[model samples]
Target: MEEKRQTALVTGASSGIGRETAIKLAGKGFQVIAAARRMERLEELARQVQGILPRRVDLSDIEDREKFCQYLSDLPEPVSVLVNNAGYSIRGAIEDVSLNDAKRLFEVNLFGLIRVTQACLPGMRALRFGTIVNISSMAGKFAFPMSGVYAASKYAVEAVSDALRIEVRPFGIRVVAIRPGFIATEFNDVGNEMTGDLLARTDPDYKPVYQASGAGVGKMFVNATVPGPELIADIILEAVMSDAPKTAYSAGFMSKVFLEQRATLDDDAFDRFLTETTGLTDLKV
Candidate 1:
């Protein structure tokens, strides 16, 4: 007997983990709607994949996002599987990032996810079954030097997922947060572009901070392999298909090490650890 097909909506499906997850879900008998700002890439994906349906929407734009949400609400099948994978980052210290830039990041990363979830919840409630896979990051648990703005967004995502899991359990809706660490993707490149020349724009005091943090980050991958998006995409599929999925799962390079330390360390101890690891301990401007 053929397995019943489910409707899955994957945001940011133009590239990286979102694209891979959409493809994998389609292979497993899902009618996958691939949403992204890049209509060309999404259309390309749809052409290559039998079950894929490409849709374009820029999550950071409030008007466009609201339109997308309304479209989701109107879907006939009601998205039982929603992968809120559309988010990007900007690298900078607290003072370096403009308030507008930070707000834009939140608009896409946190607010967009929340809005999409809201759009999908009604159908899930009606069916009494659904899975929401939120693609968080290791940064969500702990901030990295020069990456505070991005980390803050992910932190909010963690909070939402944590609370929503309990709130929606009675309706059989499962919310799973996936924390990926240092995957090989264009996500970092996008962050660099979005952040502009951080060192150039930042105060003189922050030069050393950025250099030290960069050095520390380089040291982290001396002999390690940075897995591709498939690793997390597979995890998302597992969670989506599972009868009982974990509330959270961490994968990719350095995720275990960093997450475990964050879990075990006290605030002061963790602060020291982060500083030392990020080469910020003796950073004196």
Candidate 2:
């Protein structure tokens, strides 16, 4: 007997985890609606995968998101999976980063995700079975010095997902948060680019600590055998297909390690560990 093909909507599908997840889902017999701000890249992805239907969607734009949702609601088949994966990081000390940048990060990472999920929920509710995979980072669990705003946004995601998971469970909807560690993606490069100006303007007293933390993070990403985004995609696939999926799945080796350490370490110990690891200390400039 041929299995029914489910429709999946993947945001941020132009690159990294979203792109990989869309391809993986399509390969697993899903009709994937790959949505991203980059139409050209989505077009290229469509050509690369048989089941992909490339659609341009900028989640940051309210009108664009509304139109995209309307299109999905009117689809012949209801979307069975929604991957909320569009987000970026702004790496800088909290004091150094502009409030505008922080707000922009939340707009895309938190509010945009909420809006898209809200649009999709009606369809998922009507269908009575769906999975929402939210891409959260290990940073969501622990705040790092240069990435506080990014971590704060992800922490918001975690809280939202937790509440949404409980609220939607009765309707046969499943919510899974995939927390990935240092995956080899363009995220670091983008973060560096976004924070360049802010870092340059940082207070001289805090500059060394910020620079040291950034260097440590850079080395962690470079030297650590961080799995690629495809691993996260695979985990999402598992979460989507399982009859009783876990509410959260840590997707990389380091993610698992950190999560475990978070569980075992006391607040003071963890702070000390972070300070030692990132070279952050109370030093007089």
Candidate 3:
């Protein structure tokens, strides 16, 4: 007998890991719904991935978001998977960052994710089979300077996925969180814009630290050493199809090392790791 075909909704499918994952899933005979704010890009993706439903959705808005969820929930076909991959980052010290910026970050990264999950749960429950995949970051597990708020937001996501996994286990729904270290994408380009006002207030004592951190991020972007986004796409594929997908998936070489070190490092060792990785050793804290 032929295997049953399923339907999947992927957010942030305009580019990066999300786009590749959506395409891969579609290739596997899954009817894919590619959701993102960029309609043109999504349309292009639809052409490349046969049977894809390219829907424009700004997950940041709660009301319009409901419609996207409703689209999947009401599908005559069962909605078997949801990949919550839409998120952005604001690079700056938490205290110096503007409240609005932080709010926007959380609205998209946290609130938007929650809304979609809530909207889809009922449909999944009815079917008694579903997979919810959330894209988190390595930053969620380990802390470093200038990422306090962003890390906090991802930490919340990580926590939510953990608790929800058990809560929904009884209902036959699976929740998996994928934490990527650093796959080059527009994610960093937007993160670089920490607002001029925020930059102007950077502490003179920490100038070297900021400069070093900036250079490290730039090099990481330019070097592109991490495995390509396609690797992540593959991981997502396994997560969705495997009967025993891990609760959390970590990708990239550095990311794996960082996660392992994070599990064993003391405060002093972690501080050293951050300093060496970001070239912040010369900076006065």
Candidate 4:
């Protein structure tokens, strides 16, 4: 008899890393549930990839989340892999960013991720087999200016994944954190728009620091040989296929280097390093 195909659910599947991951998983013979807020885009993805179930889900909405969970519960096959890839960045100074905006970011990035994992845990535990892959960032390891809130959300993911890895191991569930650095995606565009809005209203005194940070970001993307989201998707594929996957996997250009530097440097030294490299100290805030 033919074996049952494993099902993998990938959030933020409209584009970028999530979309690539969905396609890759489907190629690997997993039934891929591709979910995002944009139904049309999901539909397009479904057309492109065989064995993909396009789902419209907005993680920030409580009602939508509940509905999605219900749908998952009713799936014919057990969800063997849960890829928490739905998240965005909000770029601004902490003081300049609105409280509501920050809260919304947390809603999607941190709380939403947790809720989805919670929904999947029962079934995973019951089956005694599963893998949870959380898409974190290099920023989670070490934060810089202009994207502190985004970093914080990823840091929360890191913390939660560490704890969850330990908690779920006994039940045969593997939790892995995939941290990607400077992937070419629409994320940068969204971040720039948020930063632009903040710059429009920010105090002139803080504008220089903000501009410097912006320039640093632009330079990183332009000069660095940033890989596309396909590389990350490949890493996720490996994690899914591995019987004993590592707790955390860092990928992309300079991701390991930066993470190593973060681990090696003291607080003061790290601060000074960031300041010098990003030119944040050239213009005092």
The number of the candidate with the highest TM-score is: 1
TM-score of each model, in listed order: 0.97, 0.94, 0.90, 0.96
The lDDT values for all models are 0.94, 0.87, 0.84, 0.89
For 32-90, candidate 3 gives per-residue lDDT tens digits of: 88989999999998887796899998877777888877876777876779999998888
Please, what's the RMSD in Å of model 2? 1.7
lDDT, candidate 1, 1-285, per-residue tens: 976678999999999999999999999989999999999999999999999999999999999999999999998898999999999999888988899999999999999999999999999999899999999999999999888999999999999999999999999999999999989989989988998987887778878888999998888879988999999999999999999999999999989988999999999999999889887788788
Candidate with the larger lDDT of 3 and 4 = 4
- Model 2, residue pairs in steric clash: none
Off by over 4 Å in 4: 194-196
**Which tens-of-lDDT digit does each residue in 112-145 have in candidate 4?**
9999898888889889999999999998888878
TM-score of candidate 3 against the unseen true structure: 0.90
Tell me the spans in candidate 2 whose CA falls farther than 4 Å from its real position. Answer: 1-4, 218-222
Q: Show where candidate 3 strays beyond 4 Å.
A: 1-4, 193-206, 215-224
Q: After aligning candidate 4 to the native by TM-score, how far in Å is the CA of 285 from where it should be?
A: 4.6
lDDT of 2 by residue, 1-285 (tens): 987888999999998999999999999999999998899999998998999999998776778878987888788888889999999998777777789988878988999899889878998999899999999989889988878999999999999999999999999999999899878888878787877876468788877787778666566666467778999999999999999999898877477767877879999998887776676665446
Q: For candidate 1, give the lDDT.
A: 0.94
